[model samples]
Target chain A: MDRIPILKIGAALLVTIQVDLHDSVAMALEEDLSNMIVKAGAKGVLIDISALEIVDSFIGRMLANIAGVARMLDADTVVVGMRPAVAITLVELGLSLPGVKTALNAERGMALIQRRVAESGLEADHAAGEF
Target chain B: MRIRQIVRAAALEAGLSLVDQTKIITAASELARNTLDHGGGGHASIERLQEGGRRGVRIVFEDTGPGIPDVDAALRPGFTTGRGMGLGLSGARQLSNEFSIATEVGRGTRVTIARWK
Candidate 1:
């Protein structure tokens, strides 16, 4: 029943996935992120997966699902810090993560979210401060 | 998660490269989930393989639930009977160096995959 913590920064939500998540834990994360976006009026979501060693089909689908739900809730989701090996395996696993936006690191991910927020005219002044 | 750790250790012990280790571990995860969700719970076996001078790791997932009726269709990408994205079986096959599947409609399913170092 462990839940991944969601931190709110400016108008965005940040999640650092440091564990090789169990299926139920991943599901709970998706649900928790959805609720946090609505409750905090978050315009962007940043998920850091650099620490995770692997992403199977289940985790890949979870990322896509999070992006889909965020889009539906009027928010953008950016996944960052994927290791090279993990990226190669993900693509080989037949998942391109069609709808999820990715960044090489957290700085770029925050920038992508901020740019989108600025373009969308949704609280453009809120800066994504240092993590 | 225990399965993942076990697979990783086995792959490392078998002298698989980092990328190779990652591939086999991911494949084991996908197949294990299929065994649990689609096959109604099962077991996994890990083996260290040595042939001539080459080393490898092999994983086998077995289940007694309703087996896949059409393995060809099941192995095809983007095919699913459940809520999954339909990449588990096909993806697992692609990740491993050797793959084999045996299933009977009313009996059970067994998927064996191996990766060489």
Candidate 2:
């Protein structure tokens, strides 16, 4: 089975997953992603999904769970690169996902994370000065 | 399998934050499997949307198979008509910003969900 790829980029982590959008694999992937978030201690996450052709209810639920786990770990997450057709299909099916952040592409997502990190650093610096 | 993969892909593509994408995909995968297992194999649709100025992904699962008789009961969190864990419908709903179901006894079932971006 082709599994999703997980990588650490700077303080963030990138998960590149290629999925058939079918059955048991989807379930396993969900579990894997959740575990990665908990174990990796990443400051952020980027998921690349340009290869998927379908979206179903089970997968939707899993994604939501992964997001929840990432949050608990104090890491931000971003989804990138979706096909338009698949997007429409998911909407028509009435599937919903929660606790996930979205971006247009990986580059943009990474940049967003960088900016977030910078902002946080600035906040910390200011607090230090005050102290 | 296919549905789960697709959910993961879509979640990532939608630029969902890592934590958000994981949770949404997990919940979506469960619901997609339920659609196939109980509904006799159906196709799921996904879309990215912006509502009230908030961006998110929208997913729909449609099946021509036997529809649910009691949607309310089915969504009761612990309710299950099958042997697996009963968290499919309820969990999906909890993971998304909006979840709705439309079904007819002899017709079919349609589930609509919106997870804001």
Error (Å) of candidate 2 at residue A15 is: 1.7
Q: Write the per-residue lDDT of candidate 2 for residues B45-102, one digit (tens) a residue.
A: 9887766766778889899889999999988765888854466787678767788999
Off by over 4 Å in 1: A124-131
Residue B104 in model 2: shift from native, Å?
12
TM-score of chain A of each: 0.91, 0.75
lDDT of 1 by residue, B1-117 (tens): 689999999999999989999999999999988998999999999999999999999999999989999999999998999988899999999999999999999799999999997
lDDT of predicted model 2:
0.69
Per-prediction TM-score = 0.94, 0.52
lDDT tens digits, residue span A1-131, model 2? 75666776665678776745444565666667667666654567887877654444544555666677778877777877866655654554455456778788999988877777676774343233332
DockQ of 1: 0.86
